[model samples]
Target: MTAGPDRPLVVLVHGAWHRPSTWDAARSALAALGYETRVVALPSAGRDPAPTASMYDDAAVIRKELDQVDGPAVVVAHSYAGIPTSEGLTGATNVAHLIYLAAYLLDDGESMYSRHGMDVPADTTGLFPLMGSPGEALYHDVPRDVAARAVEDLVDQSLLSFTGTVTRAAWHDIPSTYVVCDDDRTIPPALQETMAAHATATRRWPGGHSPFLADPQRFAALVDDIIRSR
Candidate 1:
């Protein structure tokens, strides 16, 4: 299928502790469907020689990518990615739409830690503490092999990223759709629903946190449908 006027470039932003490769399957599926896509490598995610980048740095990277897009683009932000994506897309005219896949949608001056009613933890080793048993929390619904690989591919997220609050909420101006993974074990579904209230639209999916990993083709189709319906 040819990309229509309404079909914008798809930019995939992975969540914390995840690299760009996490969207490999979904990116391939989108490509097969004739959709051009870009996956962001979050500097705050996993940095060699330890990470020093914060959420602001991550947002700058996203802004740089959006600046390069000549036409309209749709940004898909997953989990923690939503934080930087929201901050990054502020006043970005090229962004046609935003899809938050089981992600947080913080408002201006709010942060992940603040949203949860917790104080920002002190930066330890310049990274956030990795969750225990990620395979169970993130990929319980995924295939055994895929789940294993996903766990192995997980990396340290910069604590500064989470501590940094959003300066602007892109969702306030951009039309956005929030996809809530109803069965997500990482972020509570209730919290997902709560955050979904901030979006232009919301969708609920019966899966774990990483739907793209569990079923990439189906997830890509869902993304396509959402973009088209908009």
Candidate 2:
């Protein structure tokens, strides 16, 4: 689906411990569909002198990007980035739609940590060892083989990012879509189902947490359809 002369922009936001490169496949697909796409990289999960790109800080960056775009834009947030995107686009005028991909969708004034504390299974805590110092807690959960191949791609995230509270709920106003990965090991499939129940439309795929990397073509098509419908 294509928009008018003022085509809507598609802003892709990567979650914690991930860089914008995570969405490389989706970015190419979206670009082929004639939509302007931009993938914003957040602070890594482990940086020596970590930048001030907390989840909230990342939201500010997204807000700035939204401001520069004309017409409505679709903001897609994956995993941890969902919290910030939800808060960032609350009153954002340029955002017409919001998409959450195996991501947390918190209510106003809620933080990812608090939400995770409530929703995550108790048995999943031991999945990764805690590292870093105060104010910078980072965990690694990918399988050893996967991590070995992709660990270099992971970035350090600020503990402050997860602790930051979202002051507003963007989905309350914008049309929203949730893509649930049924085989997601990082985030329990049950949790994804619960979150998808709250979205306007839900699409399910058989894959792990990184569906954009595993199956970008289908994922991109789903996003394109949403844009066309709007």
Candidate 3:
């Protein structure tokens, strides 16, 4: 689906261990193309410090954003944010499309962690740290400084965020575009390809998990193309 008469607002949903600031680079590029940007502050990502924060909580916040926004929107969900966005955009009239940027696209009744075969019970919940060699695992292909800043900005995520199952699959109805980051060390490109089977279209990037950070302008251009496509 192509962009409608109204220039779609881009609601960026960041994944685990990140804040809305993760979209700064991509937002600037989208702004240059005259696209408005809205970043969702997911409650489950440890933003609110609320005790009940889970994927469901995050979806509630996102659905509220979709309800409050002025016009058609395109939600760009990265990594774990995909789960909430999928459920959050359910029945949301303002959303024109969903752009899953290396994000999990779960089917109804699927939890992001369970989809990956993690042996977590559905009701399990807690805080999980982003432990690993940050550079090699997440940003090997990204610039050093950007990777550094990302690590500094990272935060612990709610365990339930992954264990929580989506009740509705928004991508099943909303037009979607998936991008597989070939060099990604976190989420395998092969897994991304498997997820893309449900997308309206798919693209590839020879970058790591966070291409928007590696090359924001280029990533934005790709998103702009998706916005303009049929």
Please name the candidate that would achieve the greatest lDDT relative to the true structure: 1
Which prediction has more favorable lDDT, 1 or 2? Answer: 1
What lDDT score belongs to each candidate, Candidate 1 first? 0.89, 0.71, 0.84
Task: Give per-residue CA lDDT, model 2, range 52-104, as digits (tens).
Answer: 44666778777777777777778899988888788777788777889898899
Find the candidate with the highest TM-score and give its number.
1
The C-alpha stretches of model 3 lying farther than 4 A from their native spots are 1-6, 121-123
lDDT by residue for model 3 (1-230), tens: 23344578888998887889988988998899888888999887754445457888899899988887766889999999888999888888778889998989888888876788878865555576576787688778878888888888887787667678889889988999998898889989988899889899998988889988999889988988888893
Order of the predicted models by TM-score, top scorer first: 1, 3, 2
TM-score of each: 0.95, 0.80, 0.93
- Model 2 Cα displacement at 87 (Å)? 0.9
Worst 10 residues of 1 by lDDT: 1-10
Which order, best to worst by lDDT? 1, 3, 2
Q: What is candidate 2's local distance difference test score?
A: 0.71
